[model samples]
Target: MSVNENLAFDALSDRVRRQILSILGEGGELTVTEIAESVDMVGRSTVSSHLRILRTSGVVNERRDGRRRYYSLDTEGSVRDAFLFLQTILRGGVHFDVEATKSADVAGEIQQDVS
Candidate 1:
């Protein structure tokens, strides 16, 4: 994988970051406060840190609305590239057994759904 792809995957390696991405993927944009609420046990500063990493990785877009910043998935950037890269790998004769991975948590379950 390329460096950009590697960075994207690295950003996604953290469970908290993945949860943030899941919130963004669900629908409309959310402010930092709103995002903090959705994630368990994470404080504002921590969420901000995750958002910073995600923004730096190009997986998310940030919009300034007055005093607040709203974050959402970046449709045309690293997130797209990451998904495309995974698709390419899966299409190259790789096969997965979904039932075998079902007992894992939501993070692992996502791959089963994709498969």
Candidate 2:
């Protein structure tokens, strides 16, 4: 994997970071305070730290509006590239449909539960 992909994956390995990403995915651009409030347990400083990792990994974009800084997901960035790479590897270069993959995963989980 490339450096950007490695960083993206590393950044995503944390549960809090994933939660922050989910929040950003739904809310679009949000300030540090806003994100901290949305995310449980973590404070603004911790959220800022996670945001820094996300920014360095090219998974999130940061913009400053005077004293406040806003963060949002970078749609066409390393996270997307990393997932595409994973998809290619999993599909052995064949096409992979995200919705189908999700359904398969759910079915596999249900089968495991039933077993």
Candidate 3:
């Protein structure tokens, strides 16, 4: 994998980081304290560490407002590229198990419905 791709995967491998992303994906930028509150079991410092990794991987963007730092998803970044790469491979007819695909499709549909 390319450097950005590898970084993206590495950053995403942690469950805490994934939770942080999901919190950021809620459409608005937030502070470390806010993210830590939303993400169970972790503190502000832990959230900040995850945010740092996400920023390095180009999966999230950080903004400074004087003393405060806010974070949001980076829509046009390595994470997006990595997903697009996987999508292209899937579209190229390399299929997984039909049952697994069906389950995933159903889960996606449910998520969309919730959204």
Candidate 4:
């Protein structure tokens, strides 16, 4: 797999990272304090680690404002590419009727009596 794909998947593998992404997805930029408070489990240092991974993964964009750094989603980043990959998987292969599977499942079931 490509570096971008690897980074995207690695960044997505952690619950903390996924939570951080969800918080950033809310819209505007947020500071480390805000992100930590939102996550409410990790410390500032831990959040910083997560932010560093996210930034390195190209999943988030950061900007310096005075003494604080603000973070937001990177629209054209690896995460977006990962999502597009999932979309491709969903659309690939021959089309099939899901209802047909239901009928097949019903036909394969064997009834049994239980006391």
Regions of model 4 farther than 4 Å from truth: 93-115
Alpha carbon lDDT at 82, candidate 1: 83
Q: lDDT (0-100) at residue 87 of candidate 4?
A: 69
TM-score to true structure, per model? 0.77, 0.77, 0.77, 0.78
Segments in model 2 whose C-alpha atoms lie over 4 Å from true places? 92-115
Report, for every candidate in turn, its global Cα lDDT versus the true structure.
0.87, 0.91, 0.88, 0.86
Q: Put down candidate 1 lDDT per residue, 1-115, tens digits, no spaces.
A: 7777887999999999999999888856999999998899699899999999999999899999899999998888787788889999876444444543544567677888899
Candidates sorted on lDDT, descending: 2, 3, 1, 4
- Per-residue lDDT of model 2, residues 1-115, tens digit only: 8877888899899999999999999999999999999999788899999999999999999999999999999988899888887987888434447767888999999999999
Question: For each predicted model, how many residue pairs clash, with residues at least 3 apart or on different chains?
Answer: 0, 0, 0, 0
Query: Could you give candidate 4's per-residue lDDT for residues 17-54 as a string of tens digits?
Result: 99999999984699999999899778889999999999
Local lDDT at 45 for model 1: 93
Cα lDDT tens digits, model 3, 1-115, are 6777788888899999999998888847999888988989688888888899999899999999999999999989899878877788787465556767899999999999999
Q: How far is candidate 2 from the true structure (C-alpha RMSD, Å)?
A: 6.3
Candidate 4 residue pairs in clash (backbone atoms < 3 Å): none
